[model samples]
Target: MNRRLFLAAFPAVLAAGCGFKLRRFEDIPFASLYIDAPHGGAVAQRIRSALTSSKQTRLAASAGEAEAVLVLGPEARSKVILSLSGAGRVTEYRLGLQLTYRISDKDGRTLAAAEVIELSRDITYDDTQVLAKAAEEQLLYRDMEDSAARRIMRRLQSIGPGPAS
Candidate 1:
């Protein structure tokens, strides 16, 4: 029994000795940030929720009050048929979500250039389950939106303080 316990503890001890640490959210460089996106937009809401949870930066009420402004451009969603059944009915669909964004200082100096993040997922569909498939489609889009928000957060984390012009 003691031997088994020693064996089980060895890996943990080794990891600790090697300074291994779990990956976690990093701190944002800006003290306060303003997200310029539609208030009711799903992706924007997700990003706001993530920023709030991080506690690294405060959300500014307006662009003028922020140290940096995050401008979110138009978001686009698309669904295209990737495959079809013998009867010409839809068999599979490729769903895509694209968002454009940039980061700038209150003085309008670009901290990060404009970039686009695009995500896509494929789902098999059945005509017999129209309602169920529709629900699943919505779920997939929600997942994609959440993913985009996380990606944006990661990008934000990578940005360092730029010279104020």
Candidate 2:
């Protein structure tokens, strides 16, 4: 019994000894930020939530007071039919999200060039399970938003202590 317990704990001990740590929000460059985006936008909300969750960041009241400002421009969502059944019923769909983002300093100096991030997923659909499929699609979009938020955080984290302007 003791041998079995030791065997189960051995791998964990080795992993800990190897200095493995869960990913965390690194010390991002700017301490405060302002987000410029349309109201009720899903992507913007996700990004805002992510930035606020980090203990090192503060949401500025305006662009003038911020060390870094994130400008979120046009965003789009599209569902494209990827496959159809024999009766011409949709069997698969590709849900896509396109978001354009850029970051600048309080002095209006561009810190990061404008870039577009596109995320898409192929989902199998069944006409018989419309309700379940709809729920699945919503979940997928939320997952994509979370992923995009994480990607944006990485971009910010990549900027070390640098000149604000």
Judging by lDDT against the true structure, name the best candidate.
Answer: 1
Candidate 2 residue 61 C-alpha distance from true site, Å:
1.3
lDDT of 2 by residue, 37-118 (tens): 8787787888777667776788899999888888987668889999999999999999988888888888888888888999
Q: What is the C-alpha lDDT of each candidate?
A: 0.89, 0.84
Pick out the ten consecutive residues of candidate 2 with the lowest summed lDDT: 156-165
Q: List the residue pairs that clash in candidate 2.
A: none
- The Cα error of candidate 2 at residue 20, in Å, is 2.8
TM-score: model 2 vs. ground truth = 0.88
Per-model TM against the reference: 0.83, 0.88
Error of 2 at 145 (Å): 1.0
Taking the tens digit of each residue's C-alpha lDDT, what string does model 1 give over 1-165? 999999999999999999898755678898999999965778888878878888989999999999989999777999999999889988999999998999989888898999998999999999899999999999999999988888888888899767754
Model 1 CA lDDT for position 39 = 55
Runs in model 1 with CA error above 4 Å? Answer: 1-24
Question: What is the overall TM-score of model 1 with all chains considered together?
Answer: 0.83
